[model samples]
Target chain A: MESVRKKRRKARVDETLCVACGCCVKVCPLGAIAVVNGLYARVDTARCVGCGKCAKECPASVIEVQEVEV
Target chain B: MKKTNQKHWYDYLWIASLLYLILGFFNILFAWLGILCFFIPLIISIVRGNKAYCNRYCGRGQLFSLIGGRFGLSRKRDVPRWMKSKAFRYGFLIFFFAMFFQMLWVTGLVFAGAADLRQVVTLLWTFKLPWHWAYHGTLIAPWMAQFAFGFYSVMLTSTVLGLITMILFKPRSWCVYCPMGTMTQLICKARHAGEKNSDKSDFVTEK
Candidate 1:
């Protein structure tokens, strides 16, 4: 039987408060975070390593990281 | 307009770094100093802000822009889609760390008398680079040489990665996948969080 991988944490952006300053986009190592349409930050869960860089760098404190089952 | 064209302090640091890289070939200690460029900037970014090191002192990135722009090597081509993918960058980071830890582990083995230093040095071709001459055939312990080898490996790897991407895509394209840049960004974020928390406490006290 194949072993199951543990759930991984991913960063999520609350679009409502995001100023879209692109700070998170500038800092994400994997390019997992991007500013869409110059409006708000978005995280591509598939690309996010749950490293928490985006959440920490978000000046608005609008990003959060949570564990999810894949 | 002349003031705007004035050379920044970081421009000098970049030139110093280039000189250090050449001098490091004679003394591994100089090489170690050269490599400190990464750590020093990372520390500044954490304590000051993300832009501290990146905007002010990253000589390599500046050089990339300078040369890439002049020679038209800095193409506007979109970075290869795969290069931007998480799998590639994360995999590279993981692989880099694995090699790093492996070198450290071997250093431990040498200390334990379980491994020959020369044999260990031969494990990676990178270990024998001529730039490591300062540590060779001297009183310096084999492990020191090994440590320097490992450190230089990481530095050279990052430099090459940046160079390739700078030539193939935009001058700053390597920033997209740089592990050190990511680490500094993480540090910068933590600093911001702390500042925010303090501001919140101050607000509570004032009210």
Candidate 2:
């Protein structure tokens, strides 16, 4: 049987909150973002790795975190 | 007025020198001291926040950030809420404990006598791991133990831990659970929660 693990904490970016500095884009290990209008970044959601690198890197602290058990 | 991320690109002066000399003294220096230096900046980063270490002090991480920026691969931080599971907790537990183990093992050796000493020495010259033989090379001899298998183990574990956090939380989660980050964090605990002039993490917020 294959092992399946569910994601517990959702990583989020408030577009209004995000400065679009591109730190998140540069820091994310997995390719989960597409820059919109050459300004803000949006996560593909499916590919995100929840490293929290984005959270830490976020200047706005707009990335609110909610931890759940999967 | 300099651009927000622009200053980050120009600061690489000691990037080479620091890692270069410090890596050489890995095993030669007292183990805890070596650990201390590796983490001082990291700790500074932690208490200081990820921006400090990720942007200012860390040589390797900076290079990655720079390249990622060029690729335009930089993305906003976002994910679903359900992803936060106990698995992240467990992974963090293991990652944190492992770091604790290293500090304890070293401290224990000093307090408990040769038993702890033997492990470090064994770690140094076990001549057991498949990669051990690499230490034999002229280029490899200087960094044989710590830089080779031991370093690999630490980096691999960190990388694995990092991967886990990235997959579930965000990239660079290791900075959060990172032992090195913890140390720096511990050191910088005294600052007000607001702006730290000494902090590079301030860049993300410094308007």
- How far does residue B83 in candidate 1 sit from its true spot (Å)? 2.7
For B104-194, candidate 1 gives per-residue lDDT tens digits of 7976887677876542222232534444345646577776665665565566667677778777776666655666655565555565653
TM per candidate = 0.60, 0.42
Per-residue lDDT tens digits for candidate 1, residues A1-70, read 9989789999988765444445465457776665543234577777789998667644345678999988
Q: What CA RMSD would candidate 1 show?
A: 13.8
Candidate 2 chain A, run of 10 with poorest lDDT? A32-41
TM score of chain A per candidate: 0.88, 0.68
Maximum-TM-score candidate: 1
Q: Model 2, chain B: what is the TM-score?
A: 0.46
DockQ value of candidate 2: 0.04
Residue B148, model 2, lDDT: 34
**What TM-score does candidate 1 get on C-alpha atoms?**
0.60
Best by DockQ: 2
Model 2 chain B worst lDDT window (10 residues): B116-125
Off by over 4 Å in 1: A1-70, B1-4, B85-91, B118-136, B193-207
